[model samples]
Target: MTDDLRLVDVESKHLDDVYRVRSRSFGLLSAGDREEWLSDVQGFIDDGRIVGVVDGDELVAAARIWAFQQWWGGRKVPMGGVAGVVVAPEYRGRGVGSKLMRGVLARSVEHGYPLSALYPATTVIYRHLGYEFAGGRFRYTFPAAELRSLGGKEVSVRRAGPADAKRFLELVGQLHAAARISGPLVWPEDKVAEWLGEENSFCYLAEDGFVVYGWQSGKLRVEELVAGSEATARALWSVVGSGSSISADVEAYMSPDDPAHLLVNKEADKNTVIEHWMLRLLDAPAAISARGFAPGASLEVDLELDDSELAANTGRWHLSVSGGSGSLTPSTSTGEVLRLGSRGLSALYSGTPLATMRRAGLAWGGATAGDGAIDTAFAGATSYMLDYF
Candidate 1:
């Protein structure tokens, strides 16, 4: 919120210049040898997902967002994912970055996303702006020597073409619907086109029709994996499991529990876990409503989100949901409420246990009343995300 800095919308025409600015700003690649970078930038532009900041005639900063499907916690909610936030080094400390972020976040709001998710380069910087560490991802080392073999009816896998777009997306959407940690399933048409345009990137389907489970593999990595059931998930894993080049160090994200610890493979060792991304709920009602839930009757909870960043999300509210669909409304009663700020809420939102939140001194309110509600909200649920934008 600086007076001098101004925000501008970037269009397709300015993509090359924006990438040049990004490259120069981040030292990503040698100047002028940026054909691939330009191509990636153009893809975002073509998808109608890139936004830029201009200082008069100069493009000083740029950010990109992509609309893709991800597992939220068992339901797929439309998410505005922020990425490629780059500001020219010369303008780094001049409030240009904040202006660029304000513009993009505003656009995200305009786009009707309940939340904005990003993997920030620096958590402290984003935290001040209301972003919170929502969750962490785990990289599991499924040792090649201990890799399990597949059995029980070989899944009929077929290479999918452009004609299979509808089927692929539909099946993936169904698979993510029951996932405990999933994101939006609507694929921006342009991004799909870009993924399909590549010769080495292969999309695979395993089923007779619409119910098929699907995945996409890039040249050196099995980038995306989605399936309707645990069996289907295992079948898809079998496909990637056959490849020895993937390294014993297999990687996955948005997984609620630590995958390294969850895996039964005794040989899988030297596991690594680290905080990967942060998420900010802009529309708490919409976001809380969008999440899929286990069986629950009703619970009225009050949340005081951060004022600096989640200014609109602050204040007390009541949440009621049965099955999976729910509603959040302003609370009228202060009686028997579970009171907590955005920090405590963020820790809980990111898969931290209620007891852990209390133990860490990050939570407030009466423990006896608050603990039960917090535990109920997160019970049998988990979150998972992917590193793709």
Candidate 2:
């Protein structure tokens, strides 16, 4: 059924067709809503991001790659965030979605993005394309009053707007570096302005931290809270709980090791809603070299990667690490080989322990001796993403 379809870069004129396909794939959209959606798609097309599968003149399926920088072991790495995937209702069972995703994967490699990530509505399709479940955006809920007891010296914070975009990015970079995070998205300055201008949202900036939140059903909902220092962490969290008298609960997106959790007075019921996200290594060598490893850890191991989608990644690789840095080289040497599929390797790259992968049947064979070293080299704080899409 996909034999007659052609994959191409979506152009400005294709916005209407793209919107129609998305609306039908997702659900009905009002005229006003369609215009708003088309505007966003047009922005992506103008930047040469959207890829579409066309049957003659009709856009039957589409996907977009959001240019992003994601954190890995405290280092920022280029990431292609896949989103806005849609297949026409009539074409849903004809393999159009998979064909379009393959096109997107190829485009990601050509663009030099070593890694790719996405919040999946369904895992089967992405997993088939060599993407594996890697991390999550955790949502936590607790009483606002619990945060009132956290103590800190007063730190001055002021309202922030688009003008503060640069400072906000800098602060988040600092915070992520210190926390040694994984899978957090870094937005461009212009996009920061758009976020600050969102209706009903409130943003505050401090010397070393920032908080963006809004009201939801009379409760405080924090979209993001990044702090580089203890004082900043306490100050920002206190602000969220300051309205405890009126708002009963506060829900926020946070890392599992968020400092605010430690500051609370009682054992609050923390509901961690894990929104699963997947990862794929478009360029294995580049991805390996770009990632940061544990300090004082060193290892050398051979990997046999099985990647059916990207031929360049399917082979034996010699991975070496020292002093929190790593390098990868194509190898013919028959050393202790750790065999796994591309999806499994992507999961391991995101700090999933080698032992866990073996137990899950994603990894096995040769050099059981290197398991500890592999674990230590990739180990870091838990991975989390605060941004969706």
Candidate 3:
């Protein structure tokens, strides 16, 4: 009976059971991607990052947590990237899914992740669990011939592979920090190596940047393209669009305000898809301390925050930001302080304007005077991500 369902660590032997549930919940598990999936899931198991819900011998629900360092205000903070959630259809209406995610969140906090984020299959459950819309993964498309015209033919580009992973990350760190980029993530060396070495992907390296792209549904899809200079940016775009004869269009994961868009000649309005992602603070103080603030921003605000899912986060807090860094401390408020739900604070952390949050009912309280300053403290580039998981 479902009443006997227990939350436990998933092991190698329980994989088939987990896969069965995944198939039932998400559809057929294709053989082509199964080997990679097994290897990836096994790595999570080895790292003690997999959590599951079981009834006797069957896994009724499961979720995987990825240890990721996500960029914010130009710095990276430890974040739990939750993914691959599944609950057998028959068990969906019960509390099993919640149980699995709660266990996962606890594990994430235990591992000292200050934040958690996910590209949701459905927002309701995670919203109930404390995640709020933080940012997006935007795919902007362009005619292949158009990208080709953003010439960098004078610049040199070289083929890159697994060995270039470290350099790739170094470039990313340099670019993101310099630009004060927000909301992208950097993978560990091994994961970066694995992605670079994928045979189907076209990987290239320039003096200051790199690009990874591959064919998908007759289109050249750019998984990631990070460039630190105008020349490198032009070089990468040209290389990806070089496949114009065979692929009429190109799709890339980038910010809505991406530098590449500057050279694209015209507005690209077709085939754009924005996938929203949710985030929450696992350790509110830590999350704030790690985030970079606008260098010119100055703010001192007290928030009466409520996190229904995590008791440690529910209370009054004094948030201060200056000199491109921030701090959050527990404090008593003498007046009706600004109040926010966990979701509201997270949305603000990712630079959502305070006025928008209030209208959406994500925030409230009589302390409305600080809205402009709070918004400025968190404002910068629009939040976005390149990688899906």
- Candidates in order have lDDT scores of 0.61, 0.86, 0.89
Model 3 clash tally, residue pairs: 0
Encode model 3's per-residue lDDT on 288-331: one tens digit a residue.
99999999999887888898878899999899998999999999
lDDT, candidate 2, 56-120, per-residue tens: 88888899999999999888899999999998888886888898999999888888999999989
2 or 3, which is superior by lDDT? 3
Q: How far in Å is the alpha carbon of 174 misplaced in model 2?
A: 1.5
List of clashing residue pairs for candidate 3: none
TM-score for each model: 0.78, 0.95, 0.95
Instruction: Flag regions of model 3 displaced more than 4 Å.
Output: 30-32, 267-269
lDDT of 1 by residue, 1-389 (tens): 23445666777667766867777757667555677777777787776677778766667788987664445556666777898899877788777777787777777777788777888887766765667676555444454423334321366666666667666666656655544554333675555656655676556677732221122242223446555544555555555555545455334432434332333355344545554777766677787777765556355566544455556677777767666556778876655455555556655555566677777666655546556655666554444454544
Clashes of each: 18, 0, 0
Model 3 RMSD vs true structure = 1.7
Local error of candidate 3 at residue 72 (angstroms):
0.9
Q: Give the clashing pairs for model 2.
A: none
RMSD of each: 4.6, 1.8, 1.7
